[model samples]
Target: MTFLQALWHYPFLQIVMLAGLASAVASGVVGPLVVSRRLAFMAGGIAHSVLGGLGIAHWLGAPPLLGALLAAVASALLIAFASLRIRENEDMLIGALWAVGMAVGIIALAQAPGYSVNLMSYLLGSLLMATRDQVMLMLGLNALMLGLLWLSYRPLAATLFDPEFAALRGVPTGLLYACFLIVVALAVVVLVHTVGLVMVMALVTLPAATARLGTARLPAMMLAACGAALLAVSVGLATAYAGDLPAGATIVLCAALLYLAGLLIRHLMERRRRRSA
Candidate 1:
């Protein structure tokens, strides 16, 4: 009842709830495509790579969010170019970018004079610190991603699942791939605040991973992931509030538990099917 009252009474809490749900939707939709295309590591690289931009921003006394956006987009484009076109030691290149970016961020932080802001907040995240402006920004970004995905669903699905066939069918695979990377970069920016840079990849990947265990089709997988993400975010938010826990870590842990449960259920179902056969 106290929880219900707090939600019912507070406007800021409502905004936080809205933000959490919106973030989940963004992750749910993007995660499967990422996992399907085996770009999970690349996404992780992008996530960590943003820290370099943030550190640079702090050192220069500029807005870190803007810096993060530019840095992440740059990293995403570079990886997209190397992996898609060069096709030589692609993973190694991304790995190098990841390490270098993180190192740059740490160095920037260490050198910054009289830095008072807690880096933990950027790394672990706290939903209670969410502002109305940030929530609105996430809502806008989510709408943009969904709209773009809807407009290009056919070609995008083709590019995701079967790029060779898509190209053969006149899908302009190269252009679509670049556009997809742009969308991914934007999504990462929106998600970083929700789960922080360190744990953001888990939020992006876990729900979709659990959904993948049940469905093979892209559309079905996305819907299942949305459901899983919503439940995790809602439960985690409530649990964190009651226990005075870290919101970002709590949400991610909840999602991880769901993935494990999904894996267990999938294993059992497979065994049952084999026995019936």
Candidate 2:
């Protein structure tokens, strides 16, 4: 049977596809900001810090995604506030926050009972376990994020390029930063189920990085990033089904390979241009 037939036959596969598409769109949309702002390390910090939230939720028998969202948003806010105050060497502040957040999470998890069994699943994702409800939730969150971005596009662009100038123009840069943080936090929470915390940063970064090579404009870059992410997820799912590989690892590896391929293609094109010149 064809892939479409398989998808139609297996409701679970359909759920996976929907979740993957939602994740791809969210990652693509938020990723460029992270890359453009040199916030890759900051994003990593936020991802690790979310562990604390996860631990707390697990200990209380609540949803891990809720905990992660709370923790991540707090961390993002703290980082944004610190960046405003520090004025210099913000990376150091972000790194410190990252360590503190992860340490807290580890300690909390250690105190919680019977939490180790699914620890790896949270760290590395388990796509097979994703439910239809979760997929629907992810889609809703992605739509909300896209809407927020659409509403704040101009200020966001200004803030990303020059926060001081944006503020001079009465753009409320701090509030905008906070809003972006919230969106990132939500995206991370939605993605935790399918991408996992350990590998989440890659899914958010690689597609944007690969897409950056194809375009200079923000809208074009976002489009390329979304395309790259979709390609990675689709191909990764196919490979996992065909070869019976671990789904999360397969997806990440597929994205990494695509990034490498894009780099190679860019290099070849550059060489060809040089030869013609």
Choose the strongest candidate by lDDT.
1
Clashing pairs in 2: none
Q: Name the weakest run of 10 consecutive residues (lDDT summed) in model 1.
A: 109-118
Residue 194 CA displacement from its true place in model 1, Å: 1.3
Query: For residue 162, what is the lDDT in candidate 1?
Result: 90
Clashes of each: 0, 0
Full-model lDDT for every candidate: 0.85, 0.83
Give a tens-digit lDDT track for model 2, residues 1-277: 6666788899999899888899889889988888887777777778888888988887777776778878988888887777666564667876776677667777777777773646777788888778877787788888888998999998988988898989988998988887887778777776677778788889889999999989978999999999998999899888888888877788889999999999999999999999999
The pairs that clash in candidate 1 are none
**Per-residue lDDT of candidate 1, residues 179-270 (tens digit):** 78777877787788888888878988999999999998989999999999999999888988899898889999999999999999989999
